[model samples]
Target: MKVSMGVHQLKMEGPYLTALRESNDIREDAAALQARMEEDGYIFIRGFHDRNQVQQARSEILNQLHQSGRLAPDADPEAGLVGPDNKSAFLGGTNTDKPAFLELVNSPRVMNFFTNYLGGAAATYDYKWLRAIATGGSTDAHYDIVYMGRGTPNLYTLWTPVGDTPIEMGTLAILLGSHRWEHVRSTYGQMDVDRDRTEGSFSRDPLELIEKYGGRWATSDFEAGDAIFFGMFTMHSSTVNVTNRIRISCDTRYQLASEPVDGRWIGKKPRAHETALEAPLKTMAEAKKEWGLA
Candidate 1:
């Protein structure tokens, strides 16, 4: 079982940060955006990516893996893919370059919205190279901060699905009110997780807890260009790819106005007493901040 932590530093630095800092038009209404996010735990913007671009990305990854012999034979018998649902094939960050994957990131719409949420005070903290798994029910429920310690007043995640996500199918499902992990920490408690489980595999209790809480599951049906942003501490999991198609997605992480502890990436083990994420917890203070919303 090989465990590889992703690149532990920011990608958008210097000029990029300057550009991000300068681009103020990305967010149309900061106050409204923040309000909606707080109420819904997530905000969806549709038709951000075109259909043809999405198909091209899917083809490029599949072809690369096939030519490299990484794809298996007897995948999809009908489509000439290696196995049913092309079980033998998958590609992620290492196999693709940053420029080619712009459709996944570098969207002004995405960057701008998050920039406002970050108070124009965020820096690119880290990125998870994209990973594609064979089609099946292989996802487990987990939080993003499990790998990176939850820091600052706000830590966020942007989940960009490379294609149309099926309703209640193999799509990212977030527990709506789970954004404030601290609130539920005592209620649900924590568990000891194995490294394998931390990777692409799923955990058994995610579903069990979903049933126990009478909690609702919400799936993202984003167009190729659209992206879903949520708090890093948000409880989320993916549905099994029960359909006969492939599911492709990539994610990025950001920090809002909080300082990174000692300039190091904190892991899930040896949980901390309190994270730097306390600033935003003050409802009145947060609400008082002028988002220029008037």
Candidate 2:
């Protein structure tokens, strides 16, 4: 099977792309889980959360969107079809305080998993990156470190699909073993999206990375209870949403509670990266040229 990732068609079985390996079997074994994470850079868990809880969260979120006139008035609220004139389909860093969302993210099931995985109490960022991607919407390839690496290097990102997300609805794809790319870590990984005042994405073209760095892109048909967890340096991007139904998901950060947290995402009102376009933004091309990777 072939899927589209930011205009690039990738075969699901090849050096180009493949299915993510599920680690649910060893979820309770911390040592093995850590070793697997070190080897794969990510752990895709099926049914990590309660399916009913996830569905409730999804319903709440969709209702909020409907009330805001973001969803099509003619469609069922559960369908999550975006309105024709809703230009702001991407709802990142907004609606973090919704009750259902808070419960889902901070639920004992999620928090306990992180705590056990990290071998200590876990702390999650207050800011939740909730996205409601519409048809034609897609995210570019990039490392999470570039956006939130100001604190502990051990920080991990947990991406959860709020609803059933098939390939057509778009879901995150990870570059297998990318966390160990030394050159990239020493160069692109060191970048801070806020400090540099540049676009966060490393490349809009997913094929560029595969040609330069030998690794296959991996993803799966994500269900409501499924989640993917990876460290800061992992490279990932989402497939384009080809269907009319909105693709809802959330990505949140977690790390040992004892470690220093990124100040930008801690407060009741996280002063998330100052994205006001005050100056001419630096392009990833320019950064790559300076780093001699161009």
Clashing pairs in 2: none
| C-alpha TM-score for every candidate | 0.63, 0.96
The parts of candidate 2 lying over 4 Å away from their true place are 86-88, 93-97
lDDT of 1: 0.48
Which 10 residues in a row give candidate 1 its minimum summed lDDT?
14-23
The candidate that achieves the highest lDDT relative to the unseen native structure: 2
Candidate 1, residues 39-99: lDDT per residue as tens digits? 6566555654556565666666655555655445546322323343355333322232534
Error (Å) of candidate 2 at residue 25 is 0.9
The Cα error of candidate 2 at residue 233, in Å, is 0.4
Q: Can you tell me which runs of candidate 1 are displaced by over 4 Å?
A: 1-27, 49-56, 68-98, 150-153, 180-183, 186-207, 261-294
lDDT scores in order: 0.48, 0.87
